[model samples]
Target: MTGPETDNESPETDDEPPEHRRYARYLELLESVQEADEAGLVAAVLRDDCVAMAESAVNRHLERRAAQLLTDAHFPDWARTTAAVIGDRAFLSRRLREWTLLRAIALDEPWTAEEVTGASDWFQRTAAAAQAVSSPEALDLLAEHGRTRRVRNAATLRLRPPRRRPG
Candidate 1:
């Protein structure tokens, strides 16, 4: 009998559409979570893996929520894959941690200090924008500007050029 490892070929090649494929996987997970069977645990594990793969696909682009939904799914296997894909590591960039925090809240996952480290300067300012609001109206005004989304602390600051152009 061939063992599980016998197959030399890898699964989920680059050609697959991970986004579309994940729905079927999540359906299986939903059933298993409802049934609480050993199969369900297996389904969840597989679903998490699928979510991770899907996130990596989304991560290659500048997309936010699409990638985050994979994380917001809240499986460790999934969330671990949802972070900003920087060199050799992944995370919510300093410019984007608030979105991650808000997402964590929406998902009922609390933000951890470890995840909050290396926060971008933009994150602090955006947090303050929300914090500076004292009344509902102010928040509403900001919200009108799509400010409900995480505001950048300072990713836009620019330096002035010198007046002289040497000839």
Candidate 2:
């Protein structure tokens, strides 16, 4: 049975580029996040759609919004915690780092090498690897010393190859 199409349900036309379609949907998701009540916000954050955005300006904005949504005290603890737990599953199971999940745990704050060392939880430690490119040393520390296998694995995956020493 066909239902009336709403703005959010607009069908993609043949001419639309995939990237444009994805970005359009990403914008809609952002608007939904803003309008959603606490429960709705949590649900949106944990949705596969939110996790599926490609790395781009749209995804970066989503990460920022999702991070804020997860940490906002106005939301109920169970709601925030539920999203974080689910996001963690997504982060850990995926072959690559899920920036949205990573940013959420880090509260969208920058993680210094020292802060990564001081992180109190696995998520913090894992997200700390976002700095791996900038600070391979920090990831080296985690790869060797992280308390958990998952943290160690996450760090190891992001580490840069050791430089060759000139003979």
Candidate 3:
């Protein structure tokens, strides 16, 4: 018997929105996540195959998906909590690691060691301005382990604590 995979079929002919037609598959997956229960949503996001596909997706699709995931407060928070429990290999953790570097490429933010590995030459500059400030601990982390020499030096300069007045 011929299975659906083996059967010849034309592409989807439904009256989908024009913008979505270009990335219908990704939009469909994201729609399903919206419809899912809390547990189902987590399972879908955590799937290794889904994570891999997201990692390789073209920039437009990746940015759309990431922005949606981040904007919908519950999902990103849940992903973070889940990652804390399950470990860094969680899908969102890995995606955000890439997202950070992709974002940094545009605005001159320093790259973290874990964020810059295996990046390609093609990248979009995502930010208009550098972050106004970073926490001391965060600057310390970057000063110690930022991926480039420039990043390390810049972070070290920003790592100074606030001055105290005379007693």
Which should have the higher lDDT, number 2 or number 3?
2
lDDT of 2 by residue, 1-167 (tens): 11112123346555665545555555555456443353343344345343444334233444555455444654345334445444555432231233334443335445455545555564445454554233455567678777677778877877757788999
Better of 1 and 3 by lDDT: 3
Tens-place lDDT per residue, model 1, 1-167, is: 11222223337634555444454444334333432243333333333445454334333332333343534444343333433233232432322345555345335455544333334434333433533222333223233333224432121121123378789
TM-score of 1: 0.25
* Residue-wise C-alpha lDDT for candidate 3, range 12-54, written one tens digit per residue: 6455543233234443454454433533433433343444443
Residue 116 in model 1: lDDT: 33
TM-score per model over all chains? 0.25, 0.32, 0.34
lDDT, candidates in the order shown: 0.37, 0.48, 0.43
Badly placed stretches (over 4 Å) of model 3 are 1-24, 27-51, 54-77, 80-133, 153-167
- List where candidate 2 sits over 4 angstroms from the true fold: 1-13, 17-23, 32-51, 54-62, 66-72, 75-89, 92-115, 118-167
Q: Give me candidate 2's TM-score against the actual structure.
A: 0.32
lDDT of 2: 0.48
The numbered model that scores best in lDDT is 2
